[model samples]
Target: MTNAHELGLPERVPAGDDLPAEVTVWEVGPRDGLQNESSVVPVEVKLEFIDRLADAGLTTIEATSFVHPKWVPQLADAEPLLAGLTRRAGVRYPVLVPNERGLDRALAAGVEHIAIFASATETFANRNLNRTLDEQFAMFEPVVSRAVAEGLDVRGYVSMCFGDPWEGVVDRAAVVAVGRRLLDLGCSQLSLGDTIGVATAGQVGALLDDFAAAGTPTSALAVHFHDTYGQALTNTLAALRHGVSTVDSSAGGLGGCPFAGSATGNLATEDLVWLLEGLGVRTGVDLDRLADTSVWLAGELGRPSPSRVVAALRG
Candidate 1:
């Protein structure tokens, strides 16, 4: 039997860190993780993946994206995947809706929660969303409004919040501006994304300070980090210390941005769980189950998981 202690699960050692009592680990494996894969994952495998994640105690799992298939062909099974999903109590399944058309598809599929991706840099906004920096809000406004009207929760993702490949160092003001617009458009939460993973822990704290100065509470904020520079976990700790309770992570570190060449795998959920539990913060996730799930998914993908924690716990 695989023991929990043998799973490389961190011991609970409260260092008296100023962090949230309960943190929300928003699992983005099924959608964001699989979206960038060169080969399409079977929808059946995706469903089982979500079920396993839920059983591992992830409360919010991003299911799939409703974007055009021509772009993210890996998740073309979005509709069918949602159709076959057996919803569990106390678990929220949020899907990504690219536009009003995508929002329509999500609504038709009975999606209770939807997320919109926006960019903080002009170059990234143009490349990823086919809209200019400011123009992105125009596109999101109607989608967010309609979703809110339909009584659905909306999450806004602001990519390139810390740095951009083309634009170089991103201005904190620009990120706050984009995020404020998204929140003003009725998004219940705004997830700041280090799309290229160029952020440092200092940068994370500074940006959160900027949002706070701009009258945005940390309660309405989340952090999504990529591990390109190996700073994701430290940056996540910075966010948590800043009173941000929701952290977005991918199981087994399974995703990168297809649009952003510099973007790499997201902060791994297994790694995050170990860090949080070690700090004596509550995430309500089973480390042993999460590691086992990551191992299983890695086999399905025919590759080793990039997560250091997953690699260490693979015994």
Candidate 2:
């Protein structure tokens, strides 16, 4: 598939159209990116990375996960990180919580926003969470309820929304069912994740159409894509054309899904910024600074970033 840049598309797609003029980038580098790395990054480095992201004008950043250290040891210091963080006005820091216990830790850390993850496929649910789909929802009920009661903004993540490694070609209806359940549980927004990076533009459009038909507004949805097959930017454009305003990406294409061995790093925030700028979409992010941040992070990771934009800039 040809990318938007390759097609020589116009800079601006005219206002008052189906596409939105502005987009919100939910940066997940500090959490999702680092969790998958083999080496454990220090708390100070993690804090600095997050600070740099906010400094680059990323408004929403996923700081870390509250899951047990047994599962994600890298982010075990979620509490300390939150406590030491320099909170900024109009900037949101969200943490991932697996259960009520995780929620408690997050609340104690003064986390104002949290995210819960679920799977659209049974295989992934069992492998990733060790629970059946129904059992997982049962586990999330009280967690979501408690978080909402505490006035915390809850975001739900539905993984393997398009195709699963174990089970191929997931039905659109199945994805919508899980998404609706999350919204029913009082989740303020749901992020649809292409965990294996197997989605095409047509598949993305069809799934969004199903969600819209099921009464889930596009405004309450965010799209997370992996660039394993080199389609992340194209898929994101498809989502934007369908009126999705929020996108979940990682700086420098930093991480991949540990559960899905075949997966690669996520859509690069720098690349997304490049595309959005060319399309005249406002993201409030400085593309050059964001790329420089990625380069610095890559040095800390002891490797080069996988982001195309970053590589080009370095050249």
Candidate 3:
């Protein structure tokens, strides 16, 4: 078999530093990816898409969200969809819950893990969640606390950590503060998002450095990057160099932030896997199978996948 670097892949960066041997990819295609679609995906299609992702060796998949149907009608089948899922022994399916009500619905659906989302920017917080920063925190406190108490693993998502569509150049310190608050709220991990896809590699390194300075362990952090400006892989490389192992990606590069109008899709899972495998980093994801799955999903969405790797491999 030909090695990845033999195909002209670049050498791993920051020359003497050791890259992580394995990275955990958190697949978000089902929830974040599909939520922004104009047409609602059928529940059966959503289920099969998730199954394909799992079969392709994704250990952690963000299946669906329990937010009110009014906000994301595309994911209104959260309950039934989750209920129909065939659980795998080592796989985790985490659902996004916006507030107490959402948490209630998720629990009733027998969700074992849940994620609460907040924003580093006030404008995004208001627009996305219809709550101010403080109110959003207040709203999530009990949800996180109660979920953790109930033996459900809780994850926190802090959106617009790098920049916001309405509020540009967010303060790194402010993003750190929100991240710390989420950690204090019993969240086991915090996923920092570049909601508007405005982050550069330098900014990503600096932000991770700041998080380290604030006593936030990189082990507890995951990076979610949008590919709008074509910097997602570059930014992911920077994060990996900084010891961040958990990455959020979508199959077929299928995602956009509905609230951030200018934003594009997420870093494609196949693309990320290609990069990681080329660098000799272990991701446990089958690239060819994942590409096939992306193609299948693109057919369902009635469009070609935005993933360059998927396109190239399928062609």
Candidate 4:
């Protein structure tokens, strides 16, 4: 394979106004990326994929979900996968815990970090969590509280923050209210998800401004964008301009909302790294290794990666 450097990296430009000095690339491939797969990836392969990600310098890697196997059979081997992991010193392996039962499994597996998925719209709450919008918080309250009490770092994911398939447009106030509630419930950070990828750059800036107006600092928030509408990179840039340092991405553009058919793959990590590297922002990610890792996983999944950076560099 040709070296990524041989193809030349993006030219570094002076850091723009309000852009963070450094960004945290939260890798969600092993969990979110593979959860949508039709075929189950073996536990051993999952382990290797995660190890490769850590080696590639991703400090925070979301390992797997503890959701019921009946719901996400693709990650049914979460326990074994977690057990087989060879953890790095400064790298974190967080898992998704749906509720109390999932929390129990994660605690038993010695997980130090966990993320909970929530919805901003009534329709999405009903469709995804089988609960009304208001009632969904009730379910998460106990989970967050318990996780916080256990001294585990908790991340709250608010999906459909931009747009929902069932619902046409989501209100900014509604998203802010949900995020504030999560923060109040002891979640350390809230990840705003464009679950269906319908948001534009303007929408991204407007939402982040609203969160700030509501007293939620950018440090307590993260952005997770999908590339369905080809706006993921643009939207991510807007978020960065608003001082959001932590960005969630999947390696190789591998994930979408499993509950929402309209949703597509996430903002690819390799793509994000390329952009940040060009902007002179440090993300501590090796773009070449990340692209290669994605390429390897694509082969395992029997498909080409949808990431543009991966394609461009690999070619």
- Model 1: per-residue Cα lDDT over 173-264, one tens digit each: 99999899888899999999999899999999999999999999999999999999899999998898899999999999999999998788
Model 2's number of clashes is 0
The lDDT, on a scale of 0 to 1, for candidate 3 is: 0.91
lDDT of 4 at 209: 95
Per-residue lDDT of 276 in model 1: 94
Where's the lowest-lDDT run of ten residues in candidate 4? Answer: 1-10
TM-score of each: 0.97, 0.95, 0.96, 0.97
Q: Once superposed on the true structure, which residue ranges of model 4 sit more than 4 Å away at CA?
A: 1-8
1-315: candidate 3 lDDT, tens digit per residue: 885444434344433356788899999999999999999999999999999999999999999999889888999999899889998999999999998899889889899999999999889889988899888888999999889888999999999998887878999999999999999889999998998898999999999999999999999999999998999999999999999999999999999888789989999998898888768788989887898999999999899999998877785
User: Each prediction's Cα lDDT score?
Assistant: 0.93, 0.92, 0.91, 0.93
lDDT (Cα) of model 1: 0.93
Q: Give the Å shift of residue 218 in candidate 1.
A: 0.5
How far residue 256's Cα lies from its native spot in candidate 1, in Å, is 0.6
